[model samples]
Target chain A: MADLIEISDPADPRLADYRDLRDVELRKSLESSEGLFLAEGEKVVRRAVAGGFEPRSFLMAPKWLDGLADTLATTDAPCYVMSEKAAEEVTGFHVHRGALASLKRRPLPSVESVLAGARSVLVLEDIVDHTNVGAIFRSGAALGFDAVLLAPRCADPLYRRSIKVAMGAVFALPWTRLPDWYEALPSLSAAGFTTVALTLADDAVDIERAVEGVDKVALVLGSEGHGISPRWQHASDRRAIIPMSAGIDSLNVAAATAVACYVTARR
Target chain B: MADLIEISDPADPRLADYRDLRDVELRKSLESSEGLFLAEGEKVVRRAVAGGFEPRSFLMAPKWLDGLADTLATTDAPCYVMSEKAAEEVTGFHVHRGALASLKRRPLPSVESVLAGARSVLVLEDIVDHTNVGAIFRSGAALGFDAVLLAPRCADPLYRRSIKVAMGAVFALPWTRLPDWYEALPSLSAAGFTTVALTLADDAVDIERAVEGVDKVALVLGSEGHGISPRWQHASDRRAIIPMSAGIDSLNVAAATAVACYVTARR
Candidate 1:
């Protein structure tokens, strides 16, 4: 069972993993350097443990201890209990759900392993928003997308905000970063997957028609501001557009992914 | 032509509309009481003016003046030119877009007016997040949904964050609050719409099947936390669900809205 240690001082060295939660750059560097990612809230923390992530430590208010007792019993990781105020001081934000876990991130699985039997996959290229990345994971997972392959530059799906926004979908869904961004689509095509790029190009066909009757589909999405890079756009087997109203900008990347995933899943 | 007034003081009364923008409660009350709404970024500012909203005033750095010169020439509203630092001090956040417009909020049109000749509509109930509301508007508009109807408690679409997230799609979309929440779905049904509630009820059919062959669809989505209320769920003509992977929670309301809109628009 996990040991419950009460911590009053927010400056304790043990609490370093949870400090400066609001500092994106700091957290990114800290998390990567330490090979750790944080899962916030009761549900997400529980999911992290259940998803087979080894917890380094946990932080929560005393009142929250009982709710997670069963989860704590499964791990020998130290659980630091503190007042809500102390947690806020350390995390630089209110711990509304009152629970957090810092878990070890395992080495990413090979792209080939994740795609072995997957019929539907999401390929993200430079989607830099953590929340957007998280939301897309949730949508793709819920819609039964088999796996996700992220370009080298895609936002970290394991970011704290991404974890919270995805409600731990990141843990449940199979995902790995692409080792080679340039050859990502062509390689998928060679692996018997029809790569469909979601773009606004004039030659783009309706999404419904793009993946219709296609087996082993790979749907590609782009960054927030500029869409899929010209290289990937040209390399993809098919270009699909989500038939939008005239003069209206495209849906937000997450929303577009949801719609695209739904269509691809159904197809 | 608009008057160009240079202001250095962040506490100036004329800049009240743009102050404390990060505080939701403060901005809501201030905007409502002053009969105004804020549009951030150069594009949103221009769209707000082009959407026929009367600008009460414009605030921007001197460097952004040339870009909006043509727009400012069209409005008689005062344009307050300030340094980027001064703009940040007044807004409580960095105004990276370098342009902000406080536009008059006109009285909302009747639900009947927005529904006239409308085939596809989105009805939101108690969706409190400004970003979600804005996203739904963008998705709804992009997918060719004719109108949006929000329950009385829904967040204001014209809120600065909402406008920015929606990319000013809120300005182009015809939306208004439903004065009567309890009778919302039934009222839409009475107006010849198939009130399809997006819920996870046991009886909920696939969204595509739920909206199939429906002439006029009023897709109902609930709040972020809970799905549609019991009353709204039962009052709707049919319950629809986006078929999700087993054991996964439903999509985010905005994502659900995007999928629903995409399906309904095609129907």
Candidate 2:
């Protein structure tokens, strides 16, 4: 069993990694600098560990210890038991999901490595919302897309809300940040993958038609605000759309991704 | 032109419908008792009006007035103009989108009325989350589904979060609560619509196969916690599954709806 320590004070030094979690910028910088990310709830934490992430430590309500004991035993990290009140105080929000773990962030895999031997992939360009990023990843993973490649400015998939919303699919999916924004699509094209960008560009064909018979496909999605950048859109081998009914302009980007991923998987 | 009245006090009775906007239970009861619902943001407000819901009143920051002036010109409802800070005070949250409107709720159409002459419909069972309910409505409308029929227990589509998340598709979609849950599926089946419930039951066929060649279809979805109840599942003509990748069990209910709607629309 993991060593169990009782923590009464929310200000303890050991809890520094979890402080002020609701401050997005602070959490981003702190997590990026500390080389760590958080996994909340028992299942996600378990998935993180199972996916080969090393845990730095764990915090949970006392009642949750037994439920997670077997998994905690596999790690050398200390598990801190605290009152739910104290846990909330440290996190700056209610910790209702029962358990949290701070796990070390591994250096991301290279785009080339993720793309290698991949049949279907999702390439995201500056999707601003963390939840959207996570949902897209979950869809890509669930629907048999082989990998995810993110643009330089896309929101981090490792953010806490993303982790929870994705139900830990982030851990299971192979994903990497594109090294160069200027040449991202071209590299995928050069790699012999058909790069299909989801857009409403007038020339865009129905997604079903666009993805048909492609040996290897990279389905590109853009941010909700501006959609695929002009440069990226221009570089794409083809443009495709979901073809919504009149009067409804667009689906939520995440919803669009799910639809596209599902169709692409079937194709 | 809407009578532009300036209200400086947050506690004014005219603003009561907009008060405590964040209190779910309070707003539920208040809106129910008063037969009113709110549409936030300028675009949603325009949709609510355009969708034929009569406006009870309009509330907006001064900056939003001109943008909505043409729409307001079509209504006799009073427009209450207030400072952004005062608007925040009355609403219990920041009114960042710059406008909100209270609209009179019409008596919902009957299940028979909604299903009449409709080819594709969605039947939701006890989906408790407002956001999920909204997203489903958005998906159904975008994919050319003619109407939606909800079990009595489904989340309110008019709820604020549903409206915002759905981008006001709730106003555009035709939906009504099923009067009798037990007979809902049977009635649709009798009305010449094939009832296909999305489930993970072992016998469920691939969704593509489940929806194939159906002229009139009623696509059923269930809640996050329990999925479709056994009664509803058994009553349906057939059960369909999304056929997810092995390691991942399922997509988010909303994402599943979009994917299913996409596939079903094509079928």
In order, the first chain's TM-score in every candidate is: 0.99, 0.98
Best by DockQ: 1
Model 1 chain B worst lDDT run, 10 consecutive residues: B182-191
Categorize the docking of model 1: high
Best candidate, lDDT = 1
As a whole number from 0 to 100, the lDDT of residue A9 in candidate 2 is: 95
Interface RMSD of each: 0.5, 0.9
- Write candidate 1's Cα lDDT for B1-267 as tens digits: 899999999999989888988899998899899999998888889999999999999999999999998899899999999999999999999888899999999999999998888888899998999999899999988999988999999888988888999998888888899999988888888889999999989999988899999899898899999878999999999999888899997899899899888988887
TM-score of 1: 0.98
Q: Which stretches of model 1 miss by more than 4 angstroms?
A: none
